[model samples]
Structure formats: structure tokens, C-alpha cells
Target: MTQRQPRRAYDEQGREIPPPTLADLRAEGDRTAFVHCDATGCGHEATISTDQFPAEMPFPDIALPLRCAACGSKEVGVMRDVVGIYARPRERTGWGMT
Candidate 1:
């Protein structure tokens, strides 16, 4: 199968919404969203970075236009990404220390 490239999604208002990428989202402090297949027997999941999708649209509405890429099913579940209250500690390499 050919690799699927990210496609520019559009909002109902005809605005071009850029597809989410983890790096871009993290740099801009944007919230990430997840899309999972809700099909009874389908086990598919994907993570996407987003913030107020399609021109600042809200939840449920933002999820409305999404379709499952795995099973080609419209029965999918969407939710915001969750992060733990505490982040992992980084090692003290002391490389940049003067």
C-alpha cells in the first residue's frame, strides 16, 4: 500500500485546517486529540495533535467530520489527549552548565 500523506482538512466554513503533527503541536503548546475506532470488532487507534480544530471549533463538533482510516468506518470516538500532572524528570547531564 502507498504511504498516506497528511491531507489538509477543511471546516464547514470552507477554511483549510492543517493536519496535526506532534512536533508542531508541542512547539505551539497546542492540545492533542485522539481518534479511535468505535466499531465493535475493529481495534484501531491513532494519536493526533490539535487545538480548537477547523478554526477554533469545539468538541463533538470538531469530531463530527472525522472518519476512521483503519476500517473505513465513520463510527469513531474522539477525545482530547491526556497528560499526567507530573512530568518525567530529565537526567542532569550538565552539558550546558557554565
Candidate 2:
């Protein structure tokens, strides 16, 4: 069977956004993910949120054509938290000084 390719991510007005960077994350209010560039010695990494996308959006389904700022390579990978992290109140004893 053939695999289905994911559609490009769009903005509020339905305009296609490339690479889905920090700007897209802020607009969506989604949690964070690490974007890794696939260029040798490039080591470019970025944390971006996925708020605008559906909750069930797969990692492989993210918008492609991602380019590395360091090496100008077009290969990239996205990594997300396997477990969700929660916030705690300042008054909580578990956390020390603010």
C-alpha cells in the first residue's frame, strides 16, 4: 500500500507556511517540539510549538521543505516530548526559590 503524504500547514487565512518555525508555534499555542537539521556538522536545532495543528497530527505529517539555517540543507526532523509536563504553583514545597 502507498503511504499518504501530509498536507502543508496553513495559517489562519489558509496561507501555506514553510518549515513551521517559532512564529507558527506562537500562533497555535501548542506545546513544543525540537527541529533538527540534517546537515553534517550543521547541528542546528529549534524548538517550535504545534498549536494550530490537530491534536492527532503525526510527527511525519509536519510541513516539509524544511531548510537548515546553518547549512542551508533541506532535510530536517522534529522531536516532541513523549510525556506531558505540568506546571506547579510557586507555593509548592517541591520547588525551591523562585
Candidate 3:
């Protein structure tokens, strides 16, 4: 089997930085395994399939947390409430008014 290399975080200079180990990645994955929001202090919970992930993708072991790709913040959350039409009695028209 081929030896897997850890992913590195780089500075503005583009120099090589310390990479995350498989164990580290796994730990992170565990933390966010069920999370689906981008909130401060929130861990990443979703995972991408290895086949779909790029070979050089960082943090291979740890699933990528839901974040704002443009802003790189975990402050993003999935929209769960959706508006839909439903048939109701006229007397109940004001049920969802609030």
C-alpha cells in the first residue's frame, strides 16, 4: 500500500507547514460527524467520499466542516425551514400569521 502523507497548512509565503495526521483528522471527523452548520466553535460533521475528494485535498481523514468557502467561516448553517403551500380551512388562515 502507498504511504499516505498528511496535509499541511500554509502561510502567505507558501512554505510547507505542519500537516494533520490521520489520527488528528479522524478525531476531527468524530467531532463533526453529525454537524451540518457553520457556527463559531462548531465542529465539522459531514464527510466527502474519497473518490470525490481531490488527492491533494487537505485533511483527508477529518471530514470538512460546513463553512462559507468564500469567507472560510463556520458561521454558515443550512436552511431547514422552507415555505410551502398547504390547504387549510379559512377559519385557520391566521394560524401561521405570527
Best by TM-score: 1
Question: Which residue pairs come into collision in candidate 2?
Answer: 30-51
- Candidate 2 residue spans exceeding 4 A from truth: 1-30, 52-56, 82-98
> What would the per-residue lDDT of candidate 3 be over residues 1-98, giving only the tens digit for each residue?
43334334456776666655434544433212222434565544342233333434344333454455444665543221122122234365556543
Q: Could you give candidate 2's per-residue lDDT for residues 1-98 as a string of tens digits? A: 33323445556776655544445444444376667887778889886556655655454455364567778887787665332222324354466443
Worst 10 residues of 2 by lDDT: 81-90
Q: Return the TM-score for candidate 2, rounded to 2 decimals.
A: 0.45
Indicate whether candidate 1 or candidate 3 has the larger TM-score: 1
Give the lDDT of residue 32 in candidate 1: 62
State how far residue 64 of model 2 sits from its true place (Å).
1.8
For each of the candidates, give the backbone clash count.
0, 1, 5
TM-score of each: 0.49, 0.45, 0.23
Model 3 misplacement above 4 A: 1-17, 20-44, 60-98
Give me the displacement of residue 74 in model 2, in angstroms: 1.6
- Model 1 lDDT, residue 83, Cα: 40
